[model samples]
Target: MIKKMSIVCLMMLFISCVKTKEEKNFFSNGDFYIDYYENEILIRRDAFYKKGNLKAIIEFKNDKLDNAKIYNGKKLVSQYFRKNDTLYDSETYYDNGIVIGEGNVDRWCREIGWWNYYDRNRRLFQKQHYVILNNSQLSNQVLFYKNGLLDTLRSDIADIVFYKDKGGASFKGKLIYNRKLNEKSYVSILFSDSIKDDFSNMDSVKFDTITFGDKAIMEFPVIFESNGRKNIRGIVVEQYAKEENVGDKPVNMLERYMYIDKKVDFH
Candidate 1:
């Protein structure tokens, strides 16, 4: 009777394993499949196309984004990691598995710092330095040629000059506009805790009311809050008339932010 009981227990365990396997393989809503740990925490999410081709694989830890890999059929197109859902580092590959672009994206979903772009032959063709501008949808980009020279022809920024005086260090930037400006356009320079992260507590120090121009020059004196390094942010606000068919939209406002870093010089 004891031997018979042991055999029955083995059969039940085998059945349970088979059931779990079948659930993992076929339990899907037709587009994606999810797997969970024993504690019901989601471990992996596999997304598929309508024809059952795997599209993406996203992994999570503690219910937050950890890393994600996107694919085009059997080829990996891009992969990125969001540690703690804050920092984003991403890399994209060509269809032939050659790395095309790689960069870090800030919490605001804007690309920050330096980003490299490669040609199809795996050679570095260009580099871009992205900074927060007044318009959250847009970023000021400083471009570089493959030979490491500044590519001003392709860069959005014209010129930014910094200087030191008796009061403190100050900066001025020349903005070249593609179209003529009106009276509603202005540039504001502010002091902020960070140049890239958050801009809520910024203190405006200087502003320029630009009217009727293809170019605007904005400058402000820098005031260091501490002896350590700090960041300065400049915002260019451009306003346009209300467009038709846009429901209740008063004005089209576009803002961009330019970032600069300075350190206290005791000498």
Candidate 2:
């Protein structure tokens, strides 16, 4: 009986030593291990590190990766996918795990837009807009200058209305003067009249002509003199009119003319 008791004690000691050795070897190998409760329920486990960096993470079911934190070299790096293993969110970190950036995806459901960018200091710098379009070929683009200024804006729609109902239309173009009104301001008009059934062909009512000042009273005749020099001379006219649609009505008309020196400076 004494010998049998001694053999049992020795066997128990050996088993304990073997278990301790196994635990130590598990940790030394730099691979993560899972822990459990008395009822074999899972609990949280520490992530393994190799060469001062994170290697792998050991997971559990009850208190598992769903609420666990991931680490790399003692720095939190990422959070694992959910229980379904369909999605995973990962984050990059600086040396001290300062959370440089993070990204994730939903693999099971519809694709969600995702974008990320980092700055020089490992911080988020630029974020992109991701959206699904009905036609992938048609996409909106925005441009910016180097100085962060908006230079020009344009769209894929026509906004200018020049003509409608096959009739004549009017257009206005402004000439912004820099210093003085030395150059002429061009004014043009187009007209289309209905005759039998369709409208008349398009025709220009007026063309470019030089003027004085901002008002219409100071008119100048833009012509080329005998000296071959193009001169804008001030001319006065009583009235100017063209043939009207009426025949027997007799459109009343008057005419006047005033001429200015070609070399005169109206400025």
Candidate 3:
């Protein structure tokens, strides 16, 4: 019988190579969809809950978001990884899964460096420290309690403040109506060459040119020249105005950096 029809065509090619197919699609957060499995491998991307069940699964590879879990019924609570695509490594649990919080986000999604919190008896309580700078500024943040003390420091931008004059490198600053500033402003102090250098080459070193009277907090006095191997790097803010007649150019608007050894006492 032609060798039993060649053993039934090798058992139908091993049952079509173990069959597996899914193929779902459209998921730009419109409540999730993406699934694709044997069609080309997208692995997961699901979300449900309006009478259905499962809430999140995410996982993807060549498509991006590498891992995610989140659930409530079967209890996974939360999870994250995204090895690359600008960083994510997150975590969060507590629905019995414990973990509470853990972090490292970047690609403009802020939150970087140390972040840990836990309580439902896992103890550790709180601790966040995101100092970030040229990574697009989170510029400073600190908090830590649960006995480690320190508590709060946060400040993403109050527009400008500086104030340090420890008998030397000088600084006395001000500016406040920040909605990005512009009642005639232009402050500078750049000066890099490393501390992670990024202002495309940094050099300015000193500048003022203010103009916001009636006590809208204008104060200014910048004085620079600390080249004992250079270090103060950051504090720009510009925008001096001149609409249809154009003349006194300035425009840039805000840049801040500190903590490369705590320059100007940005402790």
Candidate 4:
């Protein structure tokens, strides 16, 4: 994704610009609060709460880092501008305040141009193409389908698809968990319905929906015959790379979304 965030922004571009002569206005360590005046740079961080109120707000000037906002109580959910060290303008929100993920950044901070993503009832799912191909920097994204059609989100597996504008590749499509869905956000992979149709030559399938730390896994679709490939699948779930051994709990079940080929278990 964005080439591993440009290799972690070239390995932490200056931390907070260093400097540090201490011209501070305010700085806290309890939860997060900063306002420095060029002392060490950074003007805001951490304090991002929700439900319990007091979302976010950070501002500073004489030190080069200014502007910040992230709220859920008053609405606004994101805002940014941490110049100099890079990270020019960023935005993201969707708890009702709208605005999913606008964009900015470049001057080497990376993530530049056309970044717009939405879908909390706002539609327009994705389209982030932060160019600069040969010079190195890149981003390339583009998905949509809340009816706007044209979708394809597969930046390395757990696939996703939706198409049909008119051009012929066969038209008429259907496979999003077979229609009527809302599994709370979905996470159900359970494999083995007689191996679903075999699919050799290295079978594959994925509808993408992953996250394991907080639990939200959905990567299913692996049905390779010849006596191998089944059980759990990738997205970062090691198990000898698999050939069918699966059992210790981890599960995935989201068929018809067009790739969740039966042997589910993201262990």
Top-scoring candidate (TM-score): 1
- Report the C-alpha lDDT of model 3 over 77-96, residue by residue, as the tens digit: 76777756777787878877
RMSD of candidates 1 onward, in order: 9.7, 27.7, 19.1, 21.9
lDDT of each: 0.57, 0.36, 0.55, 0.45
lDDT tens per residue, model 1, 74-175 = 999988798445668988899888999898876555676568998887777776666544445344455556565656556545233445565555433334
lDDT of 2 by residue, 1-267 (tens): 454568889998876664221121245666544444334454445445544455445455654455445565666665545634544455555666566555543432222233354544554544332222231211112222223333333211101111122232322222212211112322222211221111112132232334333343332222222333223222222343344548677765433332221222221
Evaluated at residue 221, the lDDT of candidate 4 is 33
Better of 1 and 4 by TM-score: 1
Clashes of 1: 7
lDDT sort, best first: 1, 3, 4, 2
Q: What is the lDDT of residue 220 in candidate 4?
A: 27
Better of 3 and 4 by TM-score: 3
What pairs collide in candidate 4? 20-39, 38-63, 177-257, 188-252, 188-253, 189-252, 189-253, 191-262, 220-260, 221-261
Q: What local lDDT does model 1 show for residue 133?
A: 40
The 10-residue segment with the lowest total lDDT in model 2: 155-164
TM-score of each: 0.57, 0.30, 0.32, 0.26
lDDT of 4 by residue, 1-28 (tens): 3545576676677655655542323324
* Candidate 1, position 238, lDDT: 47
Task: Answer with 1 or 2, whichever has the higher TM-score.
Answer: 1
> In order, how many clashes per candidate?
7, 4, 2, 10
What's the C-alpha lDDT at position 107 in model 3? 46
